[model samples]
Target: MNIDQLNTDYGIPGNLTFATGKGGFPMIHIDNGKAKALISVYSGQVLSFQPATETTDLMFLSEKAYYAEGKAIKGGIPICWPWFGPDPEGLNRPSHGFVRNRLWNVLETATTADGATKVILGLKDTEETRGIWPQTFELAIAITVSTTLTVELITRNLGNKSFPLTQAFHTYFQVGDINRVEVLGLENTQYLDKVDGGVEKTQLGAVAIANEVDRIYLNVTNELVINDPALNRRIRIKSSGSKSTVVWNPWVTICANMADLDDTDYQRFLCVETTNAATDIVEVPPDGEFRLEVIYSIE
Candidate 1:
């Protein structure tokens, strides 16, 4: 729907409104008493979020990130649905499924009892979607903006046949300096090292970025903390319905090659993802539903 139609249907006075964002994509802007956020209706992606008590945004967004259709934005909490990473069937499809680049319907909007702004966006199977992956399904993402940011991805299988699914909340967080940041959690956990030929290794201590890092920590079910000394704050991530976590930073070389990211952008953001990836895939039966939720808060 157009901005006016969307506003008439789902906008919340003094809290939520529809407007055009960068590259002319429709966006939902929210400004409740406790927090502020921006959601791109084009991709159902939360592009920006900051609580009233925080000095900076909890999420990271690159200035060079593409805002055009069919291209994924470079930051915030991107929904990598259906599958994560490369095409599981090796058909050379988009690196992370088709949903991230398609438009999502605004399902609902309201103010929660806690005074947070809640917005739900959804997408269902279509002829175009079936052309890419033959599956009848419905996907919805509910975002709550309050003193903290909460995101929930819901998937329902509408087809009779069961399907295996893997996904992630590819969240990029802003940090003052990469060198001074440490990710605490998953110490001594096994992970698949994607950058080193997919070898399995155990983490030794808090994850500190000194070079290109790409690994999917396996079997994790705990809260992870990003300690940013430069920012003088800590970002806590808690998740449910996810056993895997992906930690990645493109660093210098890969950053230079990415069109949506600046060369030095690697030093400004870190990706700590909540995922159902690697061997942690889930099977969704006909008429069954699955949920992946994550909450981010600053301390």
Candidate 2:
């Protein structure tokens, strides 16, 4: 449906509305008194979110991000599905799967009991998708906007055979400054440092960003906290159905090289993803499903 049709059919008066956003993509704007959020139906991505109590948004979006078709936006909670990172089969397919770039179907919208707004978007296997991964599956992302923002990603196997899957809610959080941010709950966890040739290392203390960092932390705790002293608030992340997590910041050198990000964009955001990556893959059985959920709240 077009933006007007979507608004006419699914919009909640004074709460949720649909309109054309950057790059001419259909966007969902939500404001239910407690918080405000923006979602892109084109990428099935949550572009921005902020509770009424906070002055700044919880998510970071790069101003230079590509809004065109087939290019993933530089920030927000991008859904990396079916597979994360490089193609496992060594095909020249896009990194982090193709779902992030495809348009999603809006399935349902509702107002929850506590006055929260919920939106569910779906994507099923198509001829074009099957041509890339050949897996028959259905994927849905149910997003709830309340005082706290919650996102749940559901994956169902439609084929008779089981399929291995690795995915992530690659969340880019906006911070006053990257240097003033320290991630808690990852202390003592072992991770594969991608920046250091994928060497195995253990986190000894709170994660602090001083330079380029790309690590897949394994067997993580259920809850993590981003203590942003500059922002003067702590963002807590609670996740379920995920044993692994990813922490990344493309610091100065790499930040200068990315076309979708400004040279200083790296200093304004931090990625502490909830994921099932590296060796923590899950196999979805035929007719069965898996869920990855995360809740974000600030204090």
Candidate 3:
């Protein structure tokens, strides 16, 4: 949608503005008292969020990330829906799903009682979507930006048959130094080591960065804390309707192969995703719904 149309349709009580961003994409810019944020109208993806009290952005976006249509931006929170990771049925369509690269319609917008900007963006099944996955559905993300950032992904099943779904909020968090960062709350959890061919393994201690690491923690439903000594702060991640978490860093070798990332880009960010992957996939029946949420705050 055009910036003028967004201003007329979604602008709220606070300072909500719209403009053409990188690659000629439409974006919503918020300057409420508590925080500042930028959200892309194309993917309904949050590009940046920085509270007024914080010294740096809580979310991270890759400097070399592509900002064009049909290309997934490499940072902030990229929603992986319907199926996470590779094509579940070996269809080889897209690695994560079609939604992240598609344009989502603005369904609603409002200013909350506490002055937070709330936006609801939606995507529905079409002939285009059915070509990838044959099902009817309504997917929407409700975002609240204030002192804290909260994102809720709502999925409503409109088809008559049940469908299996796995999803994640693939969040990229900015860090002072990846080697000096630590993640807590999964000390004893068992996880699938992706780098080791998805073998089952147990986490013996709090997560620390050093080498390439990629794991999916199973049956996890608790808050996680990323302690950044270099940054002198902690990021608290809380979620609901999610039972798994993914922690990953491509590190040196893989980062060099990725076109969207710099060779050393892995040193500045960490991914701690709230997910419904592996054995935790949800089976949604006709007219059923599922919600996956994540809230971020400073500590």
* Model 2: lDDT to the true structure: 0.94
Global fold similarity of model 3 (TM-score) = 0.98
Off by over 4 Å in 3: none
Cα deviation of 203 in candidate 1 (Å)? Answer: 0.5
- Candidate 1 ranges beyond 4 A from true positions: none
Poorest 10 consecutive residues by lDDT, candidate 3? 9-18
lDDT of 3 by residue, 1-299 (tens): 67788888888645788788998988889889899999887877998999999889988899899988899999999999989899999978788788889888988888889989898999999998998899999999999999999999999999999999999999999999998999999999999999999999999999998999999999886699999998999999999989999999999999999999999999999999999998999999899999999999998
Residue 144 displacement (Å), model 3: 0.3
| RMSD to truth, every model | 0.7, 0.7, 0.9
- Compared with the true structure, the alpha-carbon lDDT of candidate 3 equals 0.91
lDDT of 2 by residue, 1-299 (tens): 58778988899999999998889988999999999999999878999999999999999999998889898988999999888999988998889989899899999999999999999999999998999989899999999999999999999999999999999999999999998899999999999999999999999999999999999999996599999999999999999999999999999999999999999999999999999999999999999999999999999
Q: Estimate each model's TM-score.
A: 0.99, 0.99, 0.98
Once superposed on the true structure, which residue ranges of model 2 sit more than 4 Å away at CA?
Answer: none
The alpha-carbon deviation from the true structure for residue 110 of candidate 3, after best TM-score superposition, in angstroms, is 0.6
